[model samples]
Target: MTFEHYLALFIAMFLVAVIPGPAVFAITSASIARGLKQGVNMTVGLLLADYLFILLAISGLAVVAEVLGSAFVIIKYLCAAYLIWMGISLLRAKPGTSITEPKMQSTQSAVLSGFLLTLSNPKAIVFYVALFPTFVAIENMTYPDILGIMACATLAFGSVNLAYVYLGSQARKLLTTPRRLTLLNRCAGSVLAASGVTVAVR
Candidate 1:
């Protein structure tokens, strides 16, 4: 893939990562209630789940892309539509209530909770499968290319997540305010919607 493509992918991933979603809420809540260590374990679980989804997206899309050939364009538009819709939904969503997570008593429990919480939202797999093709040609995927995408995803998602982990109690305090969370979501939604428009028009 071109460097420009990779950059776009990274930016898109970053925009999504910056949004305080389910995973973020969980990690931040755990950290706020417990400690940074618990948050780190939760982050680890979420990252592992992300790795699985990325792998599935790359491998599965490669075959589908190769087979569908020209028809894949339709899928791209559909994915773009989904992205735009998600963006609009987030932008309009009412300020959410404070996050509440089960007390994570141990590292294992923390990790497991994060993993299950992420996996429970199977729509996340759809996010990976849908978005990857907008930035790279999966039909031409290689081992190195796959590795690069995974690395980009890790860096983009990890950085924002770690920032949240570090913020810890402070993040919890800020997020307790619905207006602050809504503002964050709006900023993220703007980026997300613009990205979808870019993909659709490109």
Candidate 2:
């Protein structure tokens, strides 16, 4: 792909990344409950996951996509259910409830959770499967070109997500109040669940 093509793809991916989803909600909640460090860790986990998927998509692994696609409907519903459940749990968190700050998980756990969280969403899989071809010219592209594009995309996503995490951490002070925290949790949770539902329906 030309630089211009890559730029366009980056912009499109950025927009997609900005949309609220389970991952965003999870990161934001972690930030609010823990701190910026945990939030950033979550973002890094997500970036690692994105890189893995991008590599798979680039390598022409249609088998994975095909297998996942076959169960997309089931997976979508399960994800939707998980989101809604998480939202309700957040909504029900008691005021003055002290949540233990999350310690950094093992590297393997972080990467695995990140990959599974991202890969579980059939929408994301299908999206990369379909969108990757538009930006990457497989026949002519060298490995460096593919790696560069993936790295750029990962950086863009990580930067945006980190910003969100910082924002959430900054807002943590306001969330100290039990009522406020509950409300924020509910709002985030609801948004996540709704996104999942929308994905399932679509």
TM-score of each: 0.60, 0.74
Best by TM-score: 2
lDDT of 1 by residue, 71-171 (tens): 54564465346446545655665665322333434677666655544544433544676776778887888888888888887898888888888887565
Worst 10 residues of 1 by lDDT: 96-105
Q: In model 2, what lDDT does residue 193 have?
A: 59
Clashes of 2: 0
Worst 10 residues of 2 by lDDT: 98-107
Q: Number of clashes in every candidate structure?
A: 0, 0
Q: What is candidate 2's TM-score against the reference? A: 0.74
Best by lDDT: 2
Q: List, residue by residue over 1-202, the lDDT tens digit for candidate 2.
A: 6778778778877877888766676667656655677677767767877887777777675866667675655655665565555455555666555344323244454444444456565546666877767777766778888777787778677777788889889987777776777676666656655655655566
**lDDT computed for candidate 2:** 0.66
**Which residue runs does candidate 2 get wrong by more than 4 Å?**
68-94, 102-112, 178-202
